[model samples]
Target: MSHPQAKTHRMSEFTESIGTVTFSGIPNEGFLALGMRNYWDGYFAGRAAPLGLAPAEVVHAVFYNFADGEVARHIPWVWGKTTPEEAIAVRERGSAAALRQMIGDLADSSGLARAADLATRAAVSAPIEGRALYAGLRALAVPEEPVARLWHAATLLREHRGDGHNIALAAHGIGGTEAHVLCALAHGMRPEEFGRIHHLPKPQLAAVIDGLRDRGLVNAAGGFTDTGRATRERIETLTDELAAPAYDVLSVAELDELIAGLEPICAAVDAAGD
Candidate 1:
């Protein structure tokens, strides 16, 4: 089925776009690690501030904030740069004090107070289940499989351009096999259209499509199923909720200006082929 051409102002799309640009030029593994790190940092900071915790407390929270399995999955990135012992030492020694200092510094920065206030408001307005839903998606996308990476890549592309077509194009440009490209399109277009777009052989793409269909995530026509739609909507809701508090902190025009300022950088990164 064809979706309307209506415009959405979801924060997830924008954040993902920002994240995509922020990480695009880096190695894929590095980009994934950085994305997870930044996400956790922001997430913990927001969650802790409402509890009246000191900044150091929030930073220290990271050690136990995520499950051990999740930490194990991401620890390789940290370990790659530092010995495991060193990594443990750094976290043990610096997590609290550094996080506290960072928070304090942010509080002292001009306009940062407003941003924090906005973020708090957004969090309060958001659904309690939103975090869990997002966590599931994050886990799915950040896994070791190539399919996982492609999904992550597609998400980044969608955020960057706010268009699935752009995602398909960007995925193809990034050396995604045809199957990967098709999976990206399946989220936003019909199967036949996906087939027409790329001539590359992709036997696995068919299986992926079938799996999504069986799970009711996509329809036979390749449009999002109800579950898929709901997932996307939840993402938008969480982002907007988070960003709303900040909205009052910046004039509408200023936000536009910020995006405008970042556009050139995004363009350069996009042009640099993955």
Candidate 2:
């Protein structure tokens, strides 16, 4: 015969198990392991625990159980140092809810259903923002330079579409000065190379390259550095991650339709340049 309190505890555990899977992308198998670990840690320690488990033990269970490499890769950097005090501060600020709402909005605006679905799943845990804050904390742990560089490169490439002239035009158009355009172009080519392609004064081009190198966006060798490579990687990862969960939701025919829709705009832009 089961003890009534034990039975009640088991039911609660079951409910939480389902919640973790539905909301946090934590698989049910891992949930059970975490729940068991937490249960033992709390019971043995005789402490009133916020997570109903020892923090270290809970984190260990989570790391071991989650199979998705992305979450695992980020966890060490992002949540490795989250103390109870930090968690409390986050709760007080209400940043998490705001993040959840923002993610939802991004999903709708970007037509990324997978991201939207992930956001909705997260919403099940305290209105979505808290979850977002938790996620942000994890992201904070990752080294910033590599991620920032990857993002910068991705943004520039997206804007330039791999076209050198388009990059030149954009730098010139958006920068509001020849000097600024020249600086932006220095990102992708050597000083002599840029000079030959664009026919700018050699002294002026050298100055622009010097300034960019000082800013740490360009290297002395006139190529992307380690930081820049990491920046590009992070941007590509984010774009792919956001797009993956929604790919199955769209049919092959629909994707082709999207490609068809975009082709004319791309052609027009290219033709206009010509």
Candidate 3:
């Protein structure tokens, strides 16, 4: 079932781009109408809904990037307001609606439908061991609508890949907070921006950076050292290898088709600029 000649890296890049863009527009009207307190409420509850009212610790363990106590503050508590199934429904509808609004006619294009079909096959065939989030998503029915199906497939693949990425990070001794610091440095993002996203205080963020520096992964200026860049590269390569099996169901032609079909959608979403 594997195609060694398939362009695995390119496929991973395109899928990651499409998945991240599709997910960014969440907490849309349908989700907000669910009476959640804020964006975080909908985000945590909706994404974790597939896990069916799991504890914050379970979510935090799988999510693997939030600072301490962040997941606990919102989970189970949000479930009190809405059941997991309802949250899943709202998230699907909201994600599909947002994609339609952004891409116009492209959301309904035959090209997208083809891409969805291919992506869904890969997602469903992906290995589920050690991938809690993806397993939950893969258990759901693929939506009949093209846009919704595409979103569902993209998310399933994303979480499948993400779970592998977390495994890679942990194997390298990178904890959640430290991983964010390393990611910020790798992406040329300011450490402050990462802190803001994870709600890490200045002191805590500095501690993470200092630890990376001490380990020689980062310099005093918070940029990656040679060792850091190589480390990050190794982690990414391993992550790609781990995720490659998901797309192994497709041949080179289908992989190329999936990327070509998704490229325009990703471009449009990027151009929309939030």
Tell me, by TM-score, which candidate is best.
3
- Which 10-residue window in model 1 sums to the lowest lDDT? 1-10
Each candidate: RMSD: 14.2, 21.7, 2.0
User: Candidate 3: which stretches are off by over 4 Å?
Assistant: 1-6, 21-26, 195-198
lDDT of 3 at 181: 75
TM-score of each: 0.33, 0.24, 0.93
Better of 2 and 3 by TM-score: 3
Per-candidate Cα lDDT values, in order, are 0.35, 0.31, 0.82
Cα lDDT, model 3, residue 227: 94
Model 1 lDDT at residue 65: 22
Q: What are the runs in model 1 whose C-alpha is more than 4 Å off?
A: 1-18, 21-215, 220-238
List clashing residue pairs in candidate 2: 77-141, 78-138, 96-129, 96-130, 97-129, 149-231, 150-230, 150-231, 150-232, 151-231
Across residues 1-274, which tens digit of lDDT does each residue of candidate 3 receive?
5655246666666666556543555544565677888778888888899999799999999899888899998998998789999988888887777777778889878998998899898989989999999999988888999888887888898889899999999999888888777788777897788644546677878888889899999987779999999998899888888988998788878987888888898788667644
Clashing pairs for predicted structure model 3, backbone only: none
Q: How good is model 1 by TM-score? A: 0.33
